[model samples]
Target: MALATSRFLPVLDCPDPRGLAAFYRDLLGWQVTQDSDDWVELSRDGYLALAFQLAPQFVPRAWPAEGVHSHIDVFVDDLDDAEREALRLGALRVDHPPTPQKFRVYRDPAGHHFCLCTT
Candidate 1:
């Protein structure tokens, strides 16, 4: 018999799961399937899933730092266009600018870092 393994769902740790979920909801145009103070789940196309869990001791990842547990990669159609859109949506540009490779790093309003890459 073969063992059944659970699929992977990217889980982000933050002080407020609902707030972070809302940010992602707006950013990715995903609908919130489940939401609460401690946890929130967002879904798109019924497959891609993103979740957030509350961490009272949640210390935001200090990327470009010594060591960090994890980071997220977001793919976009156009790096430059996406960067501008993110800026308009209250995301701060942590890096200088997008390269020809079509990726840029930015931090959300709450300071959670994520990348915007061309798809």
Candidate 2:
């Protein structure tokens, strides 16, 4: 048996919904499909991909620390170029020791961890 779904949206909680959404929007070149004070949604092509919800007392988890549940991994044609663009879009590099060979970790402006990876 399997569950059927129409759409799937992975939402991230941040202090500022629009701000966080903007960061991802710029990073991924996605369009803002919906926006409000406490929530924002982004779409790629024509499908909803990601969303951000306002968390008033949000405390971002530190890299290499406990409480990190999951993170986003983005595939790119060129890792160097993607890294440069991500940095320019307000992403901070998180150079943990013994970094992976296929990907590099980074923290978004809202402090959520993500990876820029190459195929």
| Top-lDDT structure, candidate number | 2
- The TM-score obtained by model 2 is 0.91
Candidate 2, 1-119: lDDT as tens digits = 87797888899999999999999999999999999999999999877589999998888786576757889999998888998999999999987536465799999998999998877
Structure candidate 1, residue pairs in collision: none
Clashes of each: 0, 0
TM match of model 1 to true structure = 0.83
Q: Rate the local accuracy (lDDT) of all candidates.
A: 0.80, 0.89
Candidate 2: where is the Cα deviation over 4 Å? 96-101
Worst 10 residues of 2 by lDDT: 94-103
- TM-score for each candidate, following the candidate numbering: 0.83, 0.91
What lDDT would candidate 1 get against the real structure? 0.80
